[model samples]
Target: MALSSSSEIVRRPHPLEAAIGDTRVLLDVEQGLYFGLNGIATSIWQRLEQPVRVSDLCCSLKAEYEGEAARIEAEVLAFLALLDARKLIEIRA
Candidate 1:
């Protein structure tokens, strides 16, 4: 599903995760698939432990990372879209 700035998102409970150094590894038990997250992605995943608005998530990332707000928001939206595609997150309208 396409997500807007007002969308509220949270991680799905099914993916088992493990932190390895600065990155994170996720295992989808039902699918027997594994996914890896880099530093920035890991940060976003951590925040998704609880439900948060897309705009709020972008704002938090903008505060922590050195980047233009528009670029950060675009990247975050893209990443969230990928997670949504993988069924790793739940989105509430």
Candidate 2:
């Protein structure tokens, strides 16, 4: 499975990026790409320091975004899938 916490790796922005950026924080860094993010994405990205389960991500979505949790979960998952397709994130194993 590609949902292991370790390979789902995330890193906090060190110094400069951390100092100024809140929503723009580095969620995942690879292949010379930097995905600037906002809102639940910012929340989820920060929490993804370890390989996180989809349910865990949904929890964060619930906490961050308003409206139905299930609705937010679907939206968040879809966005995550888009990111995955972009090679921005990978399923951890």
Candidate 3:
């Protein structure tokens, strides 16, 4: 499912996470899979602790990072799509 700017998203509670240097590692016990996040991805994951609109997330990321609005939104949507595909996050209508 493609997520729009207004889509609300939140992280699932199952993944166990750990911080290693500038990266964040996530272990999904049931799936027996592990994922590693870079610094920017880690920031996005941290923000997903609660439900938030995709546009709002992009806005915050744009403010925190030096990037074009369109570029940031595009990257965020792509990243969120990956998380959604992995069942690591819930997308609400």
Candidate 4:
């Protein structure tokens, strides 16, 4: 499903998750899939500790990173799309 700036992101309840240095490891017990997150993804995951809107995430990241707003929004949306496709996150319109 396509995500818009207003879409809210929430982490799905998974079996396990761990933070190893700058990376985050997540496990889907029933699906038996292991996922790893690094760099900005790790930050994204941390932000998802609470449900947040895609636009808000982009705004915060844009302020923290040296990048164009459009670029940051596109990348954040793409990353959230991946997490959503993996069933690791839920996107609420």
Judged by lDDT, which candidate is best? 3
Relative to the unseen true structure, what is the Cα RMSD of model 2? 4.9
Candidate 4 collision pairs: none
Using lDDT as the yardstick, the better of models 2 and 4 is 4
Candidate 4, residue 3: lDDT: 92
Give per-residue CA lDDT, model 4, range 30-89, as digits (tens). Answer: 899999999988888889989999999999988888999999998998898898888999
Per-residue lDDT over 1-93 for candidate 1, one digit per residue giving the tens place of the 0 to 100 score:
559888999888869989888779999999898999998999999999889999999999988999998899889999999999999998998
lDDT, model 2: 0.58
Error of 2 at 55 (Å): 1.0
**Model 4 spans > 4 angstroms off:** none
For model 3 the local lDDT of residue 34 reads 94
In the range 1-93, model 3's lDDT, one tens digit per residue, is: 559999999898879999888879999999999999998999999999889999999999988999999999999999999999999999988
User: What C-alpha lDDT do the candidate models reach, one value each?
Assistant: 0.91, 0.58, 0.92, 0.88
For residues 26-86, could you state the per-residue lDDT of candidate 2 as single tens digits? 4343345556677666676667667677777776667756778768766766766666665
Sort every candidate by TM-score, greatest first: 3, 1, 4, 2
User: What TM-scores do the predictions have?
Assistant: 0.94, 0.61, 0.95, 0.92
Instruction: After superposing candidate 2 on the true structure, give the runs of residues whose Cα lies further than 4 Å from its correct spot.
Output: 1-22, 25-30
In angstroms, the error of model 3 at 69 is: 0.6
Task: Rate residue 36 of model 2 by lDDT.
Answer: 66
Number of the predicted model whose TM-score against the real structure is largest: 3
